[model samples]
Target chain A: MKARAFSYFRAATIEQALDAHALVGDDARFIAGGQSLVPALSLRLQAPRLLIDITHIGELRGVRREGGFLRIGALTRHCEMLSEPLIAEFAPLLQAAAPFVAHPAIRNRGTFGGSVALADPASEFPAMTLALDAEIEIAGPSGSRRIKADDFFIDLFETALQPGELITAIYVPLFKADQRFAFDEMARRRGDYALVGCGMLATCAGDRINDIRISFFSVGNTPTRVKGAEATLIGSSLNSERIAAAQAALEGDLAPPENDEVPPAMRLHLARVLLGRLLGRLGESA
Target chain B: MSGFDENLLDEADETVRVRFVVNGRKVACEVAPRETLVDCLRNELELTGTHAGCEMGACGACLVQLDGRAVHSCLMYAVQADGARIDTIDGLSESGVIADLQAEFHRRNALQCGFCTPGMLVNANELLSQVAEPSREEIRDALSGNYCRCTGYEAIVDAIDAVAKARNEGGSAT
Candidate 1:
């Protein structure tokens, strides 16, 4: 069904968008591509009084390599993340996970920051951003500031982004050449949201893992990075027994929500087993 | 009366101007705020070639090319169509490969009630453009977004396979 009546504001620049957001307060929302927001509107889940369309803001639409990090525009589409050359080089886990975000139609319109800012507990990018230790670049009336991905997610479907703040770009640190990554998710159908998902980014040299980051979604209040499991597994030579222990640790670490959509216990079990398989696959690929 | 009663926006006396290029023609007019692209194409434009089944995104009978990519039109707002170029089933009728798919659909009886034929043709045309020789699995995956409740999916696969074989063998199914 159609969404309720709301005023639409088309912003030609970032300043204009932020000002409108501030003036409108929480009643206003910044629309990048409207892939997620429109669905929420269609379902009447979100009923904002105004929609500030920032699609024409050229500042929010490029992926570039900076001195020490890869600066990706917030409005970059999901498919662009999948195939971008630099993303393939630096954020291989994001590249591996991109194809699983909705279907091609949604991928063609859904923005990276839109998903990350929405902070859906079951989304793909939040967990990946956390594992990669991404720094979110925000712009608001007070000017610019950076927030760590760890501090960005407040809770389920909640983020620390204030009403007037716009996530301009995401700064991803470099991944050493020896790094290997893998992402795995189980969905009932091709375009269905994940029942349980895992992303593994690990670096190895001479059979010893120097860096290991594991993250899971749909098994917690937010897209949670498995800190406990990583604490135990990182800097160790991951083997069959070690990997199995890590899997059990991850299962105990997650606390997924129970809903009509999924049972919490099933999601926990799936996340544990999938994390194990995904991390094991990364170890092999390395 | 029945349509209005079912419409949640029946009480809102509002309309938005929608302008877009459809099948090489510029159509511009005011539309009910709640109107969908599928309704605009099928009802307003009288391009009934883009069918609306399921009203939700599940069935791809409303599939159309929005800015060169396939999308379920029923899921899109009509106002979003402003300034965008769209290709409905009618536009694809003249597409060289679509005619081939239609002929194959006919030859293999890929359609029964003909409700899902428009979407099937649109999706199949996209696949044929990308992979002129797609395997059965690839063909299935390409049209995975579109749902067809008839022909048991076999005849459609057979039809696509025949077209692929013809293209590979340096023959024209058209």
Candidate 2:
């Protein structure tokens, strides 16, 4: 199906993008990479009056280290996640998940920030952000603010972004030497949306878990952090018994929505199985 | 029909002028704001090799090189590609960049109806460029997005694997 006709504006700067969106308000969309938004347009799921192309905005580009965090620009494409050295050194979790985000072509144009901003429940990057304790930087007419990834995603395809506000960058705390991470998902196909996916970052001290954050996607409305399971593994070394305990704790954490294709019980079961596999891998790495 | 307002169609009539380099040649076109790069390439420039199987990014049929990177042209509006360089399957074939790969595919009978061959070739070219000697598993992984209803993918993987070996050996000799 063809997309409904609309007007287009190429914004050279962040301020120009904000101004363009503000002028059209709810009728306008700030497009970067255009991976998710363009498909929505063609499907007629969303028909905006104006598309403010932010790809040319000079400020929203690059990957660099800022203080203790890795500042990943909003326009940083998915392919860059696999190629960027800083990401490999500091935010290795993102690098691990990058190959699984989509195929090479989609990865070539899909942006990290765009994926996080879209907040699709089945996507990998948003959930990985939670695992990394990343912060989302925003720019708007009233100026800018940073929101934690934990609070940025509200619901299905929903974010904390206000009208005319644009996600400028994502700031992830640099991965330290003591940290280890693992990410995996079970998809029918290699690049299809996962039936159940999870990513975890853990701080270890001689095999004893000092601190760990676990996030699971494709389970519910938002990427879920299994705090119960995380608490179960903290201060303890990963053994079969410990992994079993953590797997059991998932029942309390996730209530997978009922669906015909994959029943809620099956999804929850897959979540447990996935948690076991990821934690087992993490243990091996540690 | 009598009450249909002609002014309501005004937005559809609006066109944006975009200029870009396609397959080593400069091209210009006027397109509606919602017109995708795939549509622009096929309808305006007659580059039909870049098929549009699924408008969404899921299907790799619309893959093209945008600034040297293979991307889903269907997922991008024409206006967004202004001043960028695009290379479609026709361009790549004419340039003989994938001549060896194409010959291998043809020899192995990797494609049946050939609807998915263009995207497969584009994606395979991308993978070979990055990894000189990709294993069969790597070739299969690279083709995750490009769907082929024919040949069951074994022949396609074999063809890519063969080309990788040939290219690597050729490279090492020089």
Query: In terms of TM-score, which candidate is strongest?
Result: 2
The parts of candidate 1 lying over 4 Å away from their true place are A259-261, B1-16, B32-34, B54-56, B95-97
lDDT of 1 at A33: 64
Candidate 2 interface RMS: 7.9
Least well predicted 10-residue stretch by lDDT in candidate 1 chain B:
B1-10
- Provide the lowest-lDDT 10-residue window in model 2 chain A: A15-24
Q: How far does residue B43 in candidate 2 sit from its true spot (Å)?
A: 1.0
Best by lDDT: 2
lDDT of 2 by residue, A1-286 (tens): 9887787777888877787776678978888888888888889999887778888877999999999999999999999999999999999999999999878888898898889888999999999999999999999989999999989989888899987888999999999989999999999999999999999999999789999999999999999999999999999998999999999999999998988989999999999999999999998996
Instruction: Please compute DockQ, using alpha carbons, for every candidate against the native two-chain complex.
Output: 0.20, 0.43
Worst 10 residues of 2 chain B by lDDT: B1-10
Residue lDDT tens for model 1, B14-80: 6767899898789897776446788888778888999888665667888898887777787666776
TM-score of each: 0.90, 0.96
